[model samples]
Target chain A: MLALDIKHLNKKYEHFQLKDVSFQLEKGYIMGFIGANGAGKTTTIKSILNLIHKDSGEIYILGKEMLEHELELKQEIGSAFGDINFYTRNKIKTLTNVIKKFYRNWNDDAYYNYLKRFNLNENKKIAELSTGMKVKYSLAIALSHGAKLLILDEPTSGLDPVARDNLLDIFQELVEDGEISILFSTHITTDLEKCADYITFIDNGQIINSSEKEEFIDTYRLVNGKEEQMDSIKDQLIAYKKNSFGFTGLIHTKDFDPSWDIKSALPNLEEIMIYFSKKENLHV
Target chain B: MYNLLMKELKLGVNPFFYIMPFLTGALMLIPSWLYFLVLLYFCFLTIPNMFAGYKTQNDLIFTSMLPVTKKDIVKAKVSVIVILELMHILIAMIYGMISVRLYPNLIYLFFKPSFGFWGLCFVMIAIFNLIFISMYYKTAYKYGAATVVSITATILFAGCAEWLGIQNSFVSNLFKGAGTEHLTTHLFILIAGIMIFAIFTIIAYRIAIKRFEKVEI
Candidate 1:
């Protein structure tokens, strides 16, 4: 079953427009949503959750229309935004009590267990927690409510390397049961490389690519050669950067050739994103 | 709906603000302008500060993440505003009773804290409610323009009512002088004020729901 399905989702602001964006996430797998800043990653997530109204689109969560079954779907879907938008002055315990009442499946034991695992004190005020700790707190609340799907935006941006690894491990453990899925959105591509089963790349409010992570990585190759050969291959490159010693560019694997006499390697997710994001002026 | 209401009472209601009623209610002990200040407390201080708390805490964005509907959010917030207004008036009414007993024949510059005046206060708050809730919910975080506009209307109501009470002999005789001798007349006015309050607040709630439904977090 698909956990989330969004089709032709469009939203317009005075300065920015999300045009004809669409994607779907299969159940029991993590889909990494990759984009540069202002790439409509958050906009797409908000539309799926119905936090923002879409200008025109159909959104389905758990096989039901989102707007028609918002309360029902939201009860089963857990989400953590980039900002700690909850009451900052209140204690975590108070927030828990207030939030837990809305979900019938809320488990106290699970909540306390998560707090212990995260080394968080329920008595501590939300204001006192560091940004990484706040994300952990949000994750704890989300997990304790028997949520079948998690939507996270920039969840690892504030964490240290060890903490980010720990979070990825937790995500891995949750999906191991084949009952949970996650749509993880972030600019941190290395983290996605470790746990993402699928990847969707959005650029300038439009999706540029969406596929299995391995398939996506296989589609492109990183090519580096002597600087003098830059102009000959520039037309075929998605994006490229040059230095005094050499020039590097991203090319489709089908376009690569040994006859070019250039070194080639499988590009990482970060390289892919950076190359895709590079403007035409940067190619020189 | 009840859970949303409880969340407002639990998270949105500040302890200091909770106690502000008793502090402001004590102002009724003043000799002449007891009623106006008590009413002004709700307009000038309570509503603005409470909304500021919501803004600082980012309540609207956080609550939108919950399982409740936008209708429930509007219902919960309007209910809170009414509840706080009632609490303030009820507390001040107690102080009003004591002030009347403390000085049996004290001259009232504004309307006395009688049943009729309480009815006027209710209508006053209702006007504040209709304007404030309607305007504030349009954007959901903007309370400044709403508060200013509503308070201006409130001041106009209070000012007109007081001017009529002090300057017009028939009005003075009706509300504060011989008017107290007839129970049914004031009772009818009180009932009319309450009806207006109920109608205006309900209208405000409906308007608020419509405006808030369109707000995008």
Candidate 2:
């Protein structure tokens, strides 16, 4: 079953609008929600979690309608936002005691295990933790409640490379049991590249692409060529950048010119995101 | 619901708020026209400070992440406010009794801190609650306007009541003079005040619930 199904979700503000954005995360896999700043990634996540009211949409979690069954569905879904928005002056022990009471499936053993693994002291106040530790603490809480789905928004935004790699490993392990799924949102595409099985790219409050990670990556190529060759393929390139020496850009594999002496290679997730983001803005 | 209430006790409210009742209740020890000070102390010190703590802690955003509905949140918060208000009144009532006993011959220019005055305190708080809670819940984060409006209402009620009691002879006699000898009359006034407090607060709570339900965190 799909763990999250958001269909035709729309939210409008004075200057921005999320227009009919839709995506689904299948169980037992991680779906990377890729976008730039203000690209509607957080907006979409908030809409699904009902932290903000939507203009019109249907959000289903674990095959149940979200609005009709929020309380029930919320029990099985865990969410971590970019910042640790908990009571910063309170002790972790006190905060946990308060939060655990809301979940029927809260497991003390699991919580203690996470505390040990994350090196989080229960006696320490939330404000005392560093940014990376704060994110770890949030993940610990999300994992402790026996949550079947995890929706993380920019979870790795400020982590060190080692910490980011450690978090990616944890996400992979969580999905190995085939009972948990994650919709991880981040602008840092490398983290997703390391662990995501599927990818959904959102730009300007709309879904630009959603597909298996391998298929999506395979569809694009990074091409490097001399500056004089720019006009030959200017219309065909997804996005391009040129210095005085040379130019490099992304292009669809099908749009390649075989005789141009342009070097082509598989584009990484970051390249794909940059290309798509630039493409979307070019259209505007 | 119990969890939501506990959440408030743990994070939203501060230890100072719990101790504020006893401190403010002590104001009733003065044997003069300071009866209104007891109610004003609570309205001024406790409510605004508690709300400030809530804002500093980002309580609304944190609570929204929990597994409770908006209605549950409003209920829990309103219940906490009522509990605090009751604590202030009950403790001050005890002190009010002691002050009266300690100075039996003291002349009360304003209404004495009697059962009737406690009822008036209830009405004063009810007015504060109706304005403060209803206004605060509209946005949930903007407390300045709510506090100002509610404090203004409380001050007006206390001031008007005190002025009328002193200037209007019939009002003074009914509340503080010979009318004190009639148990049934005072009892009826006290009951009426209590009922008004209950009705006003209940209406405020319902309005708060409706407004808070539409508030997007």
Candidate 3:
């Protein structure tokens, strides 16, 4: 059974609409969700988590309908969002104690271990904690819950580079367990390169592309050419934006011409995002 | 539910909220404590402080992301308010009981030194909760607007209570009168107070949960 399955999910606001979003995360792979701000990435996740009511669609977690099994389903899912709001009055010890009661698989020892690992004090109030510290606290609780899936929204947004790398490493370790999966939403492309098996890009409330991480990297090629070269090969261009002197185009690697001098190119997720978002106007 | 309740106590609201009522209620003792209605003034301080964290722009997005459901979230908030209201009344009542002991000649202004004053307090809190919770939940996106609406409703409550006290009809009977040296509370009024509390709390919860479900974040 799939760990998560969302089909034809729709939600609308005054300015944004998540139009029939759907995707699945199997039991053992990580899905990176890339989107610009206001792109409905968080909305789609909220629907899957049953945090928001869907106007229409079906979502199943561990093969059980989400609406019918929210409490049970939630027990196995670890969730974090970019905006971390905690009770400012609560000491870290109290927060841990409170979360311990909700999950039967909760490990107090594990939670405390992480507190030490992260060098966080149990007596610190949540309001006094830094953004990076809050993220670590949320993660410590999430990981100790024995959850099978983690739905993290921009979990590393405010962290230092060393801290961010540590989080990515944790995700890598979690995936190796193979019983767990993650749907990580963030602007950090480098993190995706480290652990993502697949990617789905959302822009302006739409999903532009969904594919394996390796394939997403390999599918698009950047070629620099003058106007005449651009003219000769214009039909093959998957995406193109012109500079004053010449045109730079992203061609489908599958359709690339060996005879053409494509010039120097280094492939990466950031370049691909630029190419596609410009290509389809969210074409990624 | 208990887990989330504990979390609410710790992080959702400030400890000062709980302590402020006690401090304010203690102050009433200094003013001959004959001013039983002064407790209403104490309730005023709570509304803004109670909702201080939530009145910000990001609160909607932030609160919705927690493990608790929107329903539970609404319940927790209302519960916190109830706890505060209860704290104020109880502390005031305790001080009321002590004031009478300290100054034997003290006259019971609203209710006699007995069950009547406590009952009045209950009804007052019930009324305030219904109006405050309902208004806040509906106009939640507009924190300034909702605060103003609820504050207006509170003032209206104070005005209406004062009007009833002077006329001394159905409202006068609820609080202790001059004829009754020892105040008494009927079973029905207490029950009605609780029932009203339940109904309004449910209404507020429903409104908030529905609105929360539709929030974009």
TM-score of chain A of each: 0.94, 0.93, 0.89
Mind giving the per-residue lDDT tens digits that candidate 1 earns over B1-217?
9999999999998877778789899888787674866977888998899999899898987899899999999999999998888889889989988987888887776777777888888889889999999999999999999999999999899889888988999888776776755678777877888889889999999999999999987
RMSD (Å) per prediction: 1.7, 1.8, 3.7
TM-score of chain B of each: 0.96, 0.96, 0.78
Question: Which parts of model 2 have CA positions greater than 4 angstroms off?
Answer: A257-261, A280-284
**Best-performing candidate as measured by lDDT:** 1
> What lDDT is reached at residue A8 by model 3?
86
Write model 3 residue lDDT over B61-164, tens digit each, in one string: 54554456667767777777777677777787687677667766654444444454455556666666666666666645554555566556656665666567
lDDT of 2 by residue, A1-284 (tens): 99989899999999999999988889999999998999999889888889899999899999999889888888888888876566888899999999999999999999999999999999999999877778888878888888999999898898889988988998999899999999989989988889999999898889978889999888888999898899889899988988787898999888987787889999898888887787877788
Query: TM-score for every candidate vs. truth?
Result: 0.96, 0.95, 0.85
Better of 1 and 2 by lDDT: 1
* Per-residue lDDT of A51 in model 1: 83
Using lDDT as the yardstick, the better of models 1 and 3 is: 1
**Please, what are the lDDT tens digits per residue for candidate 3 over residues A1-284?**
58788888888777778998888778888899987777788888888877667889899887889888787777888888767565555688876776677688888788878888878899999888877788778778877888788888898888888878887887878789789888989877888988799888786777777778887777778788887678888788767888987888777887887788766364687776676667667343
